[model samples]
Structure formats: C-alpha cells, structure tokens
Target: MSSNGTFTENEEAPTYAPSIPVPNVQELVREDPSQVPQRYVRDMEDRPKDTDMSHLSSLIPLIDFSLLLLGNKEELNKLDLACQDWGFFQVVNHGVAKEVLQKMKDVAAEFFELPLEEKNKNAMPSDDIQGYGHIYVISEEQILDWSDALMLAVHPSHYRKLKFWPKSPTGLQEIIEEYSNAIRKFGTELLESFSLIMGMEKEALLGLHKQLIQAYRVNYYPPCSKPDQVLGVSPHSDSSTITILMQDDDVCGLQIKHDDDWVPVNTIPDALVVKVGDVIEMWSNGKYKSIEHRAVVNDERARISYASFLYPHDEVEIEPLIDPKTEQLIYKKVKYGDYLRNSMKTKMEGKAHTHVAKVETLA
Candidate 1:
C-alpha cells in the first residue's frame, strides 16, 4: 500500500452504509402538522413515557474535573457512583476552553443552516458512513430519526476522510480540529480516573487503548410540527468506551433511562455531559453501566448537539477484568474492530442489537 514511499490509509471497516438516502427532515418538518409523514411518527408505546422530569433533571450527577485532577479521592468516588448509577454526568471546570466550545457550536449551527444543496455537498456516500447523513437509516421502510448529522473520524489523522469535511463556513475545518485536539487530553485523563476507581494503575486503561480512536458526530434536530408524535433519535446505547457530549445550550432534548423512568437531562452552563458506553461496561466486567438514552423533539426550535466518541484500537480484545473472587467471567471477548463492524451490519439490516449479552454475577 505504499505510493512513492508514502503510505495511504484505506477505509478501516468494510462498507456498512445505509441502503438509501435519508430524507431532509429539517426541510420536511416545515410542512403542516396534519400532513406529517407516518415514517417519522411513533406509536404510543414508543414515545416518551414521561416528560415531566424537570424536577428530577437536576438530580443527575455533576462532577468537577479540576477537583478530580487535584487527587481528591472523594471526587473519584463520585465518578464511580455516577458510572455505576446514572451512566451520565456533567463535568464542570473541565479544561476545555469556553471559546472552543462556542466556536464548535457556532460552526455547526452555520453548517446546518446552509442551503440544502450546499449542505449535501458532503452527502454520505453509499459505500461509506462518514459525511452529512443519517447513520441509523437502514431500510426503505424503517422508521427514521428526526435528525441529521455530519460524522467524521477526528483522530489518528491518517484514517480521516478529508472529502467528507464541509467546504464553506471558512473556519469549520480548523475549529473542528482545534476542538478535537482540545478534548483529547481530557478524555485520556478521564479514563485514567476510571483505572484508579477500578483499583488498578492509572495508566492501565490507557495501556489497553494505545492509538485510541476518536470520532465526532455533530447532530441537528429540527423542530417538528407534531413534536410529541416523533423522536429526534431512537433509544440506543453508544458503542464507544466513553462519550463526551456537548449538549445544546439553548434547548433540551437528551434524556436517559434511569430507575425505570425516562429522565430529562438539565443543562449546566460551561459543563459537558460524559456518558458511560458499552465498552466501559464490558471492560469493567459490568462494574459500570451504559444506560439506554435518546433525544426528544420540540415544536418551537431546533436542537443541536456534539458528541466525541473515544474507542480502543481495532485489534485490541474486549476482555473484561472479572473479580475472580466474586464475579464470574461473562462477556465474550472479541476484537474491537469486528464487534464494531458487526454492530453496523445489524443496524443496516434494521435489527435490534443482540450482541453484548447482559453481564451478570455468580450467586
């Protein structure tokens, strides 16, 4: 694969793109509410079970990253509790600059606001999933999310697809790369804390994910005329080891399933939401949790979000560190690359995830 003594990066995974183009929901929602398509509408059971969790929203965990970095053991304990109980928390005093956050948000808002044809300049290719498209659209008849996004591989520079990067909004590319670099160190330090909480060396988890993979998905959820009848995104858990989320500062839609209830996530100024994903759950031998979560739509305005997903190298094995004394080996060990590709295939076939069996303890 050498060209003039220079190596080129090929697509890392096989083709798992959607079978068809996703409709421009941002434009479609502008139609009258009575004529809204059945495709985006949801049955009663699938809609939110409750939206009155405003009071409980503030109950979600809030951790101060600076305190944790100062070797405050109590903050580490809180991180452990947040992982085990809520699977989601907001981090304040995080090292990322407010300017970086605002710039990323500004460029994203400007990108989605561009003309439809202009925005589709980076429409997702049928052979790949990294571009402006809906990642969950699997079939012709499958129900679709009320949102669209631009997905990109941000780290391991060689693996990046430059063509998928947007063209206009002059600073979009630079701002994205800047924000990506800004968060890289924080994500690494956060994982180190996980290792300490697991009673292992701070570098233990870091060692397991050399050449860590990071990707960003900038999402745009348009206002729906019949908001309660549709969903912004389905209730699915992320596959990343950990996801650092930049939620909409002006609107709220992200919700997590907790305590047999769907609780709204209240936004905190200058804080980012950190989520425990399936990879962390398996790696911890189920010590941590990856709770199911989704996005809800509203009638008045659009909701925008940014998610930076971190993962282990492709060849690494997802072997759980079981407590030999109390817990039995549960999750099947598999290559990170294979597991990720298979999950994509399952989604392409419009199937519910059957992988990652429930991690359990021995009686």
Candidate 2:
C-alpha cells in the first residue's frame, strides 16, 4: 500500500475472480413484483422468520456525537456500553453537513432510477469488483439477493476508476467525492473516542495504518411480493473495522442478532447506524464484538442505503490489542488484505472469516 492509501500494483491487493453475471434484479421486479425466480429465492429454512422486535422493546443504543466531542463522561460511558452490549449503535447529531448527506442520497437515488442500459454503461468489468454491479457471487448456484447496487472506490480520489462512475447523473461524481471526506473525518473521530474508552492513547488505533482506505456500497432493494422469501443482503459481519451506514430514512430493513433473537433496527430521522466489524473485534481481542446483520425487503417500496466502510491499509496486520483486564491476546494476527479477499470470495454466512484469526486452544 502506498503512503496515500492507494494499493500500488506491486502490493498484495486482493484479486477477485469474475463473478458469474447475474440478471438485473431491479429490471426483473419491474416486470412482475409478485414472484421471485428460483435463484433469488432463499430456502425455507434460510428465509426470514418472525423477526419483529416488538418483544425486545428497545432500539439499539443511540449516541450523541455532540456530547462525546464535549468530553462528557456520561456520554462516553454510553459509547462504551453500546460497543460492548450491541456491537452496534445509532449516532445522532454527527457533525457532517446535512446538505452533503442529502445530496449524496439524491444522486444515489437518481443514478439508480436511470435506465438499465445507461446504468450498465459502467458494468463491473470481468476483472474488478467496483462499478455498477453486485458482489460475492462466486458461483452460478449461489442464492441471490433481491437487490441492485453501484459499488465504488470513493476515497483516495487518485485511486478511483472514474470510468465506472455514472455520468448521466451529473454531479453524482462530485458529491460522492466530497461526501467521502466528510465520512472519513467522521469515522476517524469516532475511532479516537473508542481508543479513549479502551484505555489507550488517542492515536493508538489511528497509528495502525499508513493511510486509511475507504469505500462506498450504495444498495438498492426493490419491493418484493414475497418479501420474506428473499434477502436484500445476506447475513454476515462486515469485513471493515467499522462501517457507518446511512439507512433508508423511512423503511426499516436492517436486523442484528441479539440474545438469540433477530432484532430489527429502526432509524431515527437522520441518525447513522454504526457497525463494529470483524477487524474491530480482532484488534480489541473480543472486548468489543462484531455481530451478524442482514437487510430484508418490504412488500411495497424500494430501499436505498449508503454505507461507508473504513479500513486500514491492505498491508497492515491486525494485531490484537492485549486487553489489560484479560492480560492476554485471544486473536492471532491476520493481514487485512488476506482477510478481505476471503470474505469477498464466498457467500456470507455469519462471521466466518473472522474466526480464521482466533487462536486455537486444546483441551
């Protein structure tokens, strides 16, 4: 990795084998919103069951970034509990300008609403994962998600493949680049807070990388007739250290597992949902957890979510930060690039890749 966070050619950047081309899911739903094709249908056991969270009577913990910035101890403790108990939290009043956020959302909506041909102009090449396409489709027999997406490399502007970005949606390119910086700043600030809570120097976590790498996964899930029969995204833990997701403002589709029950996460106006991912769990030596989460579709409306994934440089190793309380490390070191490639090559079935780093113990 270069000092600017770009993966240079000689660096061990993960290579993705070309995925078998999939049908344009958005187009399929327009012809008939009623039945999904067999490839898109999840098995009876895999389909979503009753996941309503009415029984839990609680939403994920909400943290006010304003208070954390003010160094309020009470709010800091809430941050600690949110990481430990849920491995997820909703952040409100995060300082990024509302207009920047709104514009990014508008462009994403406009881009997805374009005709399939116009959108496909930037179809993901047989050799790469970025551009107008979905990922994790390594096999023809894999169960498909009922979604269409335009994934992109948004940070380290020089590292981008501009040819894959949509040109029809004028300014779509500019807003994404601007918004990337805002999100990068936001993620870094939150990591500083997490470092304080972990009893480490504020730069401890930040010091792990030469430059942080960031990317965006903009998702579009069309309405389904049998909403319970297909997932918008499969159940899996994120491969990033922390992923900040801007949920669909009005629709609720994300669910995280808690206490043996799948709990639906409800968005509060503009609050962004923060997910603790596999790398965070590894570095924290499991003091904080990375939990499995999935997205589902509804019977009536399409859903759009813009998620920003934060990562250390590809060459950096995720060494477990020894927990003072435990006085030992539980996770062995794993290079980020290797872990990332493993997670992207196959279907997500939980935190499968993260387990590869756990130290073995014999009876």
Candidate 3:
C-alpha cells in the first residue's frame, strides 16, 4: 500500500511465510485442541483472567439515531458525554436497514469459511497491506494474533482492487458496496454531529467540502485452544478520524480499557460500535481521548467483525481545532500523508504514536 492508501499488486511473493504451515485455527480447535503453535501463545503476564464486572455495571451509552436526526437536546448531550468521557458508544436505530447488516455479516462469514488455499487467492502482496494477510508481523519471534483479516479500500472506488475481493461468495461485492455507501453517508453525518457537540459549526472541525476516505477490515478471529493466551487483535486506537464497527451478534470478545480495567462491550442488537480515532483526538486538541481497545478470541466459536474507517483525503493537512474556551492547541500541523507514513513505521500497541504528534509544554 502506498502512503496515499492505494494498493498495487506485487508479482513477487513474500519471503516470510512461517516455517510451519499456519494451521487453520477454526478447524484445528474442533479436532485437536493442542495443535496451537507456540508463536500464538502469550506470556503469563499478557493472559486474560476472570475479572470483576460488578463495578462496570454502567455500560457504554447507546445513542438513538432518530433522536440525533431530530436534534433532541437530551440525546445530543448524551452523544457529547459519550465522546468526551468514553470515546466509544453504540448507535442504535441507525438508518442502515437490518437486511443490509445481515447480508454483510453473511457474506463475511462465507468468505472466511472458504478453504485456506482458496482464500489465499486474495492474499495481499508482500508490500501491500490491503488484502487477506496478517499485519504488523515484523519478526519471527514476535507473538502472533489468533486472527486473520481481509482489508480493502471501499470509498473513492477507484482505489479498490477487485481481484482481492472474493468472487466465490455470491453477491458479496454488491452487498458490500451497498453497505459501504450507506456507512460512508452515515459516518459523515456523525462527524458533523461531533462538530456541533463541540459547540462549533456542523462542519467547523471537518471542512465543508472535505472528501472522506473509507476503508474496510473484515476480521476473522477463529476459536483458539488457549483463548487466555492469544488475542484476536492487539490493543491500539485507530488512525482514522472515526471507525464504525459491525460486530458479530452472537460473539463477545471486544473489550475496552477503562480506568485500568478491561471491560467487555456487550453487543446491542442491530447497533454499530462508534469509536473515536487518533485524528479526532488531534482535531479536538486532546479534549477527547482515542480509547484503547482490543479483541480476544473465543474458545469454542469464531468471531467476525467489519470495521469501516472514515479518513481525510491524503493531501489534507491536520491541525488542532481548538475551542478558545476549552482547549489549547496541543498538536502541530502535519499532512495526513506524513502522519500515516510515520505511524506505519511504529508498532500498533498503544497511544505512543499519538503522543509523538503532541507538542511538548514546559512549566
């Protein structure tokens, strides 16, 4: 993938395929529980353990889209608090038809269910990060996640590479395109709402005519023999302005770091998870944090999620949009292209990369 986020096919195959064939975790767990590779195991310190949930009784806020459209004051207040305090929320009664959501889930499951060799046809090139493959795998000794992902650009349709898209899953392309269009429109509305919540004009932070770029990640977290030791995705905040996630209804693995504890985000029927990304934090001048979150694998069932990220055009320059009464500019102006290039060089673990963009202040 280029700095502009376009993917090009490289004829050469990657030289870094694992020495041992990567076992299909979904099938292997159903047959033999102990076949999990040592590389997939986590150290004792990184394992998941039973934690107290009683203190986390207050679930993340769920904002009704109808209320947002109606401009209800109370609902708008909730949206503000959710962004300012939690940086994550569930949007219920969202306009996307139930049929569209179901079809997206169905197609995603169907695509991942294909045989490993069949799925490899869409494998990403060694240099491109926008197809079926693992990401951020820098070394053989690094711990691997118990997941597989298919990533592709959805918006600015010209950036899409149809060859990486699955043709076997009947109607996959049509449904995904329809779904992507709907989400792109809805995501724009949400960004406008964010500006209003910040007491600015609807398009103050985000420009009036700025074109947003959308990318999709279809994540497949297969069942793991040692669920406690492996994570589906490592902890990291998104690099986009906002991310809308369509999670598997029957699975529960998405967790958010809250006040030193990892709390599970319960799935709300027909609701999409809205996340504040690093760009938003910079835009807000550090007033709202980009939450740290991760996904864990299930012991018996596989998990799937589709995340749509809304980003600014590559040429856009990002600068802190500070509100005189509340915020002071904390980050310097930088081009989106430069930021992305610098970010790609670092590991996606925590908010360290975001911190790099911050301006140091002296006492």
In candidate 1, position 25 carries an lDDT of 87
Candidate 2: tens digits of C-alpha lDDT, residues 130-190: 8888788888899999898888876555557778888979998888888888889989999
Q: Per-prediction TM-score, please?
A: 0.91, 0.93, 0.89
Q: Ranking by lDDT, best first?
A: 2, 1, 3
For residues 1-363, write the lDDT of model 3, one tens digit per residue: 455443434322222122222444555565776677788887887777677553563578889988887878899999888888888999988899999999999988999888878888887766556778766665667777788888887767776777888786789889889999989878887877888887888866557215567889988888876788888888888888999999989888888887868888888788999999888888777777788998888778889989998887666778777655675668877777567656655656767777667776710
Question: Number of the top candidate by TM-score?
Answer: 2
Which one wins on lDDT?
Answer: 2
Pairing residues by index, what is the TM-score of model 1? 0.91
Sort by TM-score, top down from the best: 2, 1, 3
lDDT for position 47 in model 1: 74
Worst 10-residue lDDT window, candidate 1? 345-354
lDDT of each: 0.81, 0.83, 0.77
lDDT of 3: 0.77
